[model samples]
Target: MRFRDGQWLVAEGVRIEYAEEVYRITPTPSGKGISLLCPTRKVMSRGDTLNLGTLSIDIEAAFDGVISVETTHWQGAIRRGPDFDLFPAGRPDVDAKITKTEAGTTVSAGGLSATVSGKPHEFDVSFHPTAGGKPLTTLLNRSVGLAYTPAPSSPMQLADTRIFKHYLFTQTTLSVGESIHGLGERFGPFNKVGQKVDLWNSDGGTSSDQAYKNISFWMSSRGYGVFIDTPERVELEIGSERCCRVQTSVEGQRLRWYLIYGPTPRDVLRRYSVLTGAPGRVPSWSFGLWLSTSFTTSYDEETVNTFLSGMKARDIPVEVFHFDCFWLKAFQWCDFEFDKDMFPDPQGQITRLKADGVVKKVCVWTNPYLGQASPVFAEAAAKGYLLKRKNGDVFQWDLWQTGMGIVDFTNPAACAWFVSCLERLFDTGVDCIKTDFGERIPSEDVQWFDSSVDPKRMHNYYTFVYNKLVYETLQKRYGTDEAVLFARSATAGSQRFPLTWGGDCESTPEAMAESLRGGLSLGLSGFAFWSVDIGGFEGYPPPWIYKRWVAFGLLCSHSRLHGSNSYRVPWTVDDDDQSDEGCSATLRKWTHLKARLMPYLFSQAQACVGAGLPLSLRAMCIEFPDDPTAWSLDRQFMLGDSLLVAPVFEEDGTVQFYLPEGSWTNFFTHEVKNGPGWFTETHKFGTLPLYVRPNTLLVLGKEGEKRTVYDYASDVEVRSYYAREGASAILVDNQGNKLGKLEVKNGEVVGSEVLTGEFRITVVNA
Candidate 1:
């Protein structure tokens, strides 16, 4: 991935051909783009072009505020399948024009423009605002080229004797003080400087540089973003290979990317959603507390009922109950049959729970792989629905399950077969699914049912297909607005699936903060809804830690309590079982608070889906792009446009958070503070710092609301926080239908005719 050793040296056995001169520039056939032919060397004589390599570069407008640049070494390479499904909603029309002058050729689309220098012996592509300002980024001389590993001795080498791999790469300039973010659920540093990020989904937990969701997009602090348009592995050296440039390299002959101009980070995200797709809308009931039977824990129908009953005894409502991997018999994962020994009647249990109002939904764990021990595996293999090797044998691995073969979603019959499996689950009273473990897809020496797909490309793209198929099936069964999925792995367009959670993490404070970082990174990458295991996933969280994480997790857009070796039920995890301020009490308080806040939260969720913004745990940088300190803070996040949540990471409940220049009102204490500075505070297990921004209207549902599904328009409290005269809150019903708006008029809160709720208005800091 890194071809250069330093400023002036190439890595050993790596051959590089740097584009040195722009030999020719012509308009594209569409007349909306420019094409360039750049030779590796400056041609001083007519014969100098005879035996030199030339890089073909094309520049076009993908949409408004987005420009595409594709560089290729060989034009004859066959294009493969498994490509990204860009513009899934449909492409927008753009006003693109080409202008050629004596200096260069500039292609302008919307307000973005790219100018390529026409001077001989010089190669430069400068991207800037069409209205004219500082350039966003530039590709200088020797920045675009082809690289070969284990360099061939000569050009005349025979094809059978040659043993080498070639790569196409591009390096773009990074402005001073610029930081890069969002390579998909990254858990390392908040900023991606001095890091070599390989875009491949992995099963690595929260402490490693590897990520579970490896998206190919990164937003820069300099008001622009770059999206590598490939499903294959893309290695990015962000100021690591070259101190002043971000280098992107991919195996094969071609590499393409989109340069999106935002003037603002939020604008950049809005444009990105248009290019890929906006995040899907999740059901409103999913916003409440979800209790799961922890992985590897001894859980049966009795244990599940006991946990739900325990929560009910403590005044905590479990909106959704999930059964983790042990739901099926051991060694038979995708057989889709409940373990009869554990639960004699699985469907009856779900029915009883829902019938008794104990839980609203039931979710079960599944993956794209079927174990050989499963009877369904033999059926799938006989039906040619499993991935096969070149010799036509079913591919098998023992990493997660013995002889697990991946379901070949590339085949239509295989997809239908999987759909039938899901239909059976749906018929058995399962409401949703926990689609897990698509990150470990094998791409070596394997043959897909669709032979046109490159194995390497299918590695990360596998999650997209796997999740999309399941999501569509859910939408077909449930209504579009009623579908939800707790998926683990993802690629670029996987945001189209409703919800995804941060994968396995330790039960330490550091892991909690890292999980927040991962959610922030993913939020910046265009994902709308994200969650974390309430008390971490690997081990038992201490009472204080569990209490603290309960507050944090419940505040996420989607909350789920799950763990690996131990149950995450609050009563079981709390050390002081008799104390009133224990984990169970904390869980109860936060769950009720989320239910009360649903009026505002659901409205904000609707806005996020419409605008391509993250619903919960949004990075401060996205909302406060002008604040330099906001870009570096990852421990704290803005829950929506109004509230800022700083989770207490220390065992003593100490937390430090920043508020941009504004008057912030504490939601709990009702105390107001003016800040453009850092504030540290210590809280008990019951509460943390939750602040309301200035000039905002905060809405709340009925007090002591138990269930998440309710008439949000009825029995609501509208709180005003030193808001301007025009400040308002948009209201929606339990079914996500727009009702009306409540606004301030004549110094009083007034509602439109459609706002038929019993409104109680209170001014917090007015």
Candidate 2:
């Protein structure tokens, strides 16, 4: 994807043509946009324009504070399918005006404007805030171009026969102190400068450059965001190629992108969700702990019951019990049938688990692949429900299973059939489904049921349709605000699904930090809910690591205990010691602590659903955009808007975190500290660095409330910390319905009518 060798010379066999001059500018009929004719070279005369290529650039106002720029080299190429589902809810109207003066042409819309320079032989477009300040970014001369890259393995000796792939590229200026963040669940450095990121979904675990979710949107620390509008392959050189600009390139005839201007970083996220879709509403029960039967481990009906029973005896309530891939027989993943030999009766077992109150919900794992060993594969292949090759044969691969064919969700019959399969599971008392492994979809030599979509474009977009089908099915079965998904893969608009988890990771402190980085990055990308494997998913975590991860996982939006080859049950991992710092004890402590936080957590979640903000594990930069140090700190995150959590990443529990200018009170201990500084502290396994920010009112649930789903407005304790005028807290019930608000009015805390049922008011650091 890099075409230059240190900026002085182009890479071998690469030809580049820069857009040198703006020949003409014409306003569109809609009066909301302008198009520019840009030639590849300076047109000295009419003869200089002969035998040359011209680039057409269109700038349109999308909505408030958003404008799109599309550059095209060939305007006659056939437009393809599988485009992103932008503005899925509806498009908002904008107030736009196009004016031309002697100086130049400027199109202003929604407080943001794009101005085109009128100087001859100078191709310059600058985006600025309408309130009059420095430009956000500028596309200067030599910034827009097209390149011809030689095909792989082209012989150097046969220059006449070499083939080339064409691409359209644009580079936008980057300021000196601007930092870039978000590229869909990136596990690398949070600041993406000096990194070349390819937005392709892959299954490479948390330790590598491969990402399961690759969203083509990023926010700049300078308070603007850019969303590349393509599901096809996109390569971004964030200050890596030119060191002064962010270069974005895509193969094919045209490249379109939108620049969203937000006076604040949080406003940028809100506008992003308007273009894509807002995150779906999640159920309150999902905030509780989820226990999974590890993959490839020995698990039958008895084994599941024993794990549940041990947790119950240890006072660690498992809200949702998950059965991993072995629920179905080997090599028959999408069969959707329980192994009769292992379980004997799945419905009866699921009924007993729920009826006996051992677990409140049951989740089973499934994928979009149907192996040939299962009889259902033949039915699907015969009925044209599976993806086909160019020659009308089913596309089969042996990566995860033998002769596995992907289910074509693009086909309506296939989607209906998959719904029937899920309906059968719902009949068996299963409440949730873990939609896993949609990242490895084949994109070459494949023909989808919908023939209009390009195969290469469907590579990263496959996860969106797959997860959307399953999530909609769940929504139809369970009413509004009740559907949830533990999905593994995602793209731009996949945030419409309720929940997703971090993919495979190792059992080490480094992996834990990587999970945090990925979650924070994804949160920046507009995903509202995220989870991770408690003790890691690859190896058996030691007791200390397990206990440390338990404290961190319980604080996520959703928490799950899972592993690869070993069980994540507390007793199975910890020694027989029953002290307060043991694995079981630590798990019990955090589980109950989270239960006590349900009142505040559910309200935060409800707010996020409406505003398109992350409810849990929010990056520090989003909360404190003016603080320079907050943009680079990734080790800690804000649980909601009020509480800050720094996960202990060391074996000795030594941790360091930053706090903005405010008064912070320790949540575990009542000690108060004044900060706009960094602090380091050490503790045992029972606690980590958790603090409450200033000017906040925390509505806490009862101390001994064990269940996550209960009447949150009843029997709650209201804690006011440094309460200031105009400060308030919104309250909601278990079903995410607004109850009332506790507002600080005239220096007095007054509650609305709905804050009923024996509430106690406690003051902290007042």
Each prediction's whole-model lDDT (CA): 0.91, 0.91
| Per-candidate clash tally | 0, 0
- Candidate 1 lDDT over residue span 18-98, tens digit each: 989889988777777988999999899999989879999999977788999999888988999789999989999989988
Which numbered prediction scores highest in TM-score against the true structure? Answer: 1
Worst 10 residues of 1 by lDDT: 153-162
- Model 2 segments beyond 4 Å from truth? 151-162
Alpha-carbon lDDT of model 1: 0.91
The residue-by-residue lDDT of candidate 2 on 470-502, one tens digit each, is 899899999767899999999999999979999
Candidate 2 lDDT at 635 equals 96
Off by over 4 Å in 1: 158-162
Residue 203 in candidate 2, Cα distance off native in Å:
0.6
